[model samples]
Target: MTETVAEAVARRRQYIAGGTMSINRAIGPAKLFVRAKGAYIWDAEGNAYIDYHAGFAPYLFGHGDKDIDDAVIAAIGSGASLIGAGTMPWEAEIAEMLVEAVPGLEQIQLTSTGSEAVSYALRLARAATGRDTVVVMQGGYNGWSDYVSYNLMDPGDVVADHREGDEYPLRVTTAGIPKVIDTTVRVIEYNDLAAAERVLARGDVAALILEPVLQNVGVVKPLPGYLEGLRELCDRYGTVLIFDEVKTGFRHALGGYQAIAGVRPDLCTFGKAVANGYPMGVVGGRREIMALCNDPDPGRRVIIAGTYNGHPVNVAAARASLLRLKARERDVYSELERLGARMQAGIEAIFARRNYPTTFVRQGSAFALYFMDHAPRNWRDIALHNDNERDLAYRRAMIEAGVFHFPAATKQSSISLAHTDDDIDRTLALTEDVVRTLG
Candidate 1:
């Protein structure tokens, strides 16, 4: 008996279920991804979408970049991974490139994902300083690792009527995470120097881990002198400074946030765009701090080990991607900024005309639109956002109008080197249409 095409498709979905696949939402019913190229993707039905999210801001060079593809292909032909404890040539090259691009990165360690990188960096900091406590900024996301996952949000814990000069206590995001972990971690608001100093002065804190520019909460930029002040405070307090550059790395600049901010961190974790969407992460910093990993006294050292930490194929892809980025570094950043500015300006103009309650926050080329009356300074401010319904409507309209952005209302949108002037113009036009539809 011959089966019909519709029946075959249904069988496939049943046999290999897609993630969170359901037909109830505004967008998820269409399981139609067929092909992708630079800045655009075609659905199984052959409909095209102008990709604005860039795989959650990783594909800086965009999808199907020939340079990265060729490198991966060549590496696969040679071998993907080596036998126990062997070095790959591309690993050294990638390390050197990262160190050169990032300031004061005398040593580097590779990992398979951003979470692993942050996890290892925190451990290294604790081991080096012999301190158990870590200070994390409120609303800053440093991956899904257990340590950083605390203090994200809790409706019960929020101070509804927070007042000036009042201490806001840290609240855990999830329940299963031990309350003792909360004791080991201190939470403070970003760009609040006084609050950060108070937390650091506790002396038990080993490190302060944060994204130099908060992308997860929205593209929230650090207040003037905030980063420099953090660097100074950490220095004075003998605490390790860590910059979680997972999202901003490579996208903000070739050297990552440290380069753009001109502030050196004791350690920095990078992922997302490290291999241009390939699953790779890196942690690097001053040699003295990193040397804690190689302490002669084994009992006093930290060890990071992973089977696919520096998988040859990933290293090869990273090396090639880094080289391509270096060659086109100026053009990539300039074009992204130029295009981002144009898009933001266009969106703002549309908002002004419609009198919509919306604002755009940008950091370098990465930006997010907050459908709120004022800019968000922290997660609490973000929680106050009331535009969820309207934002979802706008996102659906954009998707239906041939543009793809992050489904969430508060997440950021990335402008890639692969995006052309035409792509930007088209995106602006579609965005205007979506905003106009909101009225």
Candidate 2:
């Protein structure tokens, strides 16, 4: 007797309930993946699905690239762990590549995850400036840490109703964060220069952290001159401008959004695509700002030290990934843009023909479907989604039709160098069919 798919799913759910760190509201019966190669993944029951999320936008070379795998194997054979050592040779190589690729990155500090990198960057900014207040953009997500989670509006709507003038200034998204942490965080609207200026003029801001391209809520592109204006404001006010390029770094272009947009930030945080699926993060910036980490007086400044700051295996993977990006930069970006445009156009046509109240937002190779009348410019606009049920229904239908994506409804589908014309065509066709069925 063979167990059904439902039974397997139920068993998985039981395992999850037994004890697992529950982050997102993952479905009880998640699809159990057995293997993945190139652009497709196979489930435990040997069903294949075309993966569109690209491992949350990190596997730009696609799943199971032989070059990266070989590099990882070589590094492992040599020795994998050197947690608190002097330096791994590959770490220097990655750092050199990063500084050379990104114009604003004069020096960098490596970390194990995007969250740690971001937290460290914020701490550096505060130490360098001697200011405690951090002004975060309305919808930008830096990490899950307390210092940066004050104002993550679903659609760019800050819950001002819950605020009183200077009375316990911090608002915690989760329970573990102390209420007093709010005093160090100030929330402002993205792309709104007037609102941002009002806050920056307060003289207490140590840094202005934002995702140049918002990837979590939706792929919201920055408005014309918005990033440039912000750069100028930060400079004028002596605030450190930190671009959270974890998602947009290697995806948009070889140098990331800063290169494409032609705006230089004081500091930038990168992860996700840097190691091509390996756990790695980097915080880099002007030499002066980064030097604070090495300040002789430990008691006078912030200290950042991570156990897995630049693991040998991860560094090797990053070096290999960066080499691939450098070698095929033009072809990779062009193909992704072309294929993404085709998919977006096809999806838009489907929505138009069926008269569905849906809009697609795209930037370069990343795209997302928002159940709204128009593309969202900020978090507030995204928060206006009317039908989460329908959104989930469409996502489930797409998955059932053999298209895999991040389970989050707000996720953006990332196009990879390995995705071909046929992959794009199939994805569009399946999406069209799914939209029709939804209608």
Candidate 3:
């Protein structure tokens, strides 16, 4: 080991905000990673770990993918990334590919990050519908925007009652957000059709936004008829429907969960694995709504402008990655599901043997281990029922045992195409021992 982890944390704190960029802090000081490759990462101290964190689920093919890296390098060498200038030909090519892959996407607007993409989606909805209020799902993370920042998975007692008599107040997660911001956004429980109906029926909501599958706090799945109900409600109320797929976009499926659910949102935001960890985001949806941005009148149009809107290097990476996924969609997605199921069965076996009541929830490659016996429906249930202390201890044990699952409780762990049967077996063995030691 070159330096103590404490020393590394202290040094990082000197520059980085809160010693890290994400609010989901580790149980202990954050590990300083230096290098990575397929399915594994090396810490600054040169400790090798099988990486379940997987760069927050963006490394779909795993870190240091040759094709994606080569594409980025080639784009840079070709001088295509001249920054803040003419549109690259590959931009339209990538957009075309996305439209073909993702259902209900007729047009796409590019952005540098998912947060920015969601902001653009919201503004487009506001412009098209001529409404101001937004309805969001509890525990759904729509990035750090003021519009979607409220009701994020917080460390403490974060979930609050959405309705108090005649009024609903915003549950601000961060401090700097104004109290008035609450009035613009309404929070509803995911998978609760009645709550969604109650909120959307008001007809004031410009957009009803949520993750089709809640990934921010342990992949809470949408119950049957839940998403379809939202779609119907949004149509009835003249509101735009948005699916914030930053986490679930390309990781679970190239077409996303919407393709599987057979329910489409009017607008959808994509990022994370879209560029295989390259900085890129895409907001795509119906042509009727997205055309609002192209409105000729300068004052009435929705502005979808950004300096890095379609950076050639990032677009190249994304195009190559998506092409790879498209080329091997059957093999890639099937392998991920196979590996994920194997890991899920192994974890459940450990808990069953240990007599620990746990709920292991998964959809495709993303999974979570909750100490609660039942499947949690939303953030409130997760807060009241899931044992954070036990989950934190389990994650800490994984960290010490050469398995790098992220530290925060209820955060989903990912399986990548780079992860093979051998990796899952090794992780299962380590997890068994960790569960044994918890007594």
Candidate 4:
């Protein structure tokens, strides 16, 4: 007999420590997803969902994208799972494409996951600058590394003392991190140039890292001249500027958000949609800084190594994804913008008649619904004013109604290249129904 959803959930809980691989996966109602194709996912019990979550914004072209899948299948057929000894053609191909695309990426190295890429970037920065302390945004999520796992979605009270030029108390996201790690990190609110300068001016800081647009907390975009200001400050202070673009990379543009912003960082990290959901991460930037990974002097080398660092299958998928993005750049981005605009407009109209305070914030194909009157400027703004309960409740309702929005406050919902006008129409209708019953 096949196991039911309940049985599967129970069995998972019995074996898995938290019934999920990642703690973030614990959010929302559980479902046993049997299969997924294009813009839809099917549960084991025959229920289908118009998937807006898109595996945490990785599926830019949608699930089981033919171009990426075919490339992966071809790589598997080549019978070169892990040569482990020398360079692969796919690695060179993808690296060349990434360098050509991203503005700051003169050279790049791959990792199996974004978290690992971030770790390597930080290592390079520390070695290059000869400084141990690092600075990061208060609400930004830059992988699970101890150096960065701080102040992601802290409570209002924890950040109540925050001021424009002051750093927030470091609220470590996980417990197992060493107490000494906290000493090296300083957290500041997004969009505050004064705070960033104050922290970086200490002259002991190694690197200042951030998501250019602050995506981790529902798209708090940088204010005018913010990126440029940070660039100037980093140059003045001799600190390495790193853009943790894992969430904002290819999803926003082929060259990553740095290309769009036109303010290049010394180093940038990428993953997720770069491979169209394949497990691949990239760290690239100025050739001098990146070359530290294979420095001639043993003392100067910042080592970067992984068994599956440039696995052929993953490299193939990334190469295919970038080629398709480059070939159909106009059609692809325009369609994504169209679909995203339509969804945002529909949601705005739905809540216009009602007295609910809501803001539909979007950047390119990524979007979020915050139950607040105005767009949030930073995490403290969301924590102090946004209605967390209502946002989560609305998302939970949508999930039950077969429109899969991650049922958590401030988590982004994605629109894929495969999402059709009909998908948007159905999503709007479902949004209306959920909004009606939200009370």
- Estimate every model's Cα lDDT from 0 to 1: 0.80, 0.81, 0.86, 0.90
Candidates, ranked, TM-score: 4, 3, 2, 1
The residue-by-residue lDDT of candidate 4 on 360-433, one tens digit each, is 89988999888999998888888898988888888888888999988888888999998999999999999898
Output the number of the lDDT-best candidate: 4
Error of 2 at 88 (Å): 2.9
lDDT of 2 by residue, 119-188 (tens): 9888889888998888887667888889887756633233433222222234566778876777788876
Tens-place lDDT per residue, model 1, 1-439, is 6555455466767756542243211233344566888999887666799987776678888898898999999988977655646675667777889898888578999999999999999998898788998988777889877799866643423745543223357666756887778678877777778888887887878999999998976788887798999999999998999999999888888888788789989999999888988889998788988887878998878898898888877788788888877898898788888988888887788787766688888875688888898887776677666376777677777888898876766777887778888888988888888877768
Q: Candidate 2: deviation at residue 295, Å?
A: 1.4
After superposing candidate 2 on the true structure, give the runs of residues whose Cα lies further than 4 Å from its correct spot.
Answer: 1-22, 80-83, 155-170
Model 3 segments beyond 4 Å from truth? 22-27, 154-168
lDDT of 1 at 81: 58
Per-residue C-alpha lDDT of model 3 across residues 28-124, encoded as one tens digit per residue: 7467788999999998787899998988889999999999999999998987864576666787789899999999799999898999999999999
Worst 10-residue lDDT window, candidate 1: 19-28
Overall local distance difference test of candidate 3: 0.86
**Clashes in model 3: which pairs?**
none
Worst 10 residues of 3 by lDDT: 160-169
Better of 2 and 4 by lDDT: 4
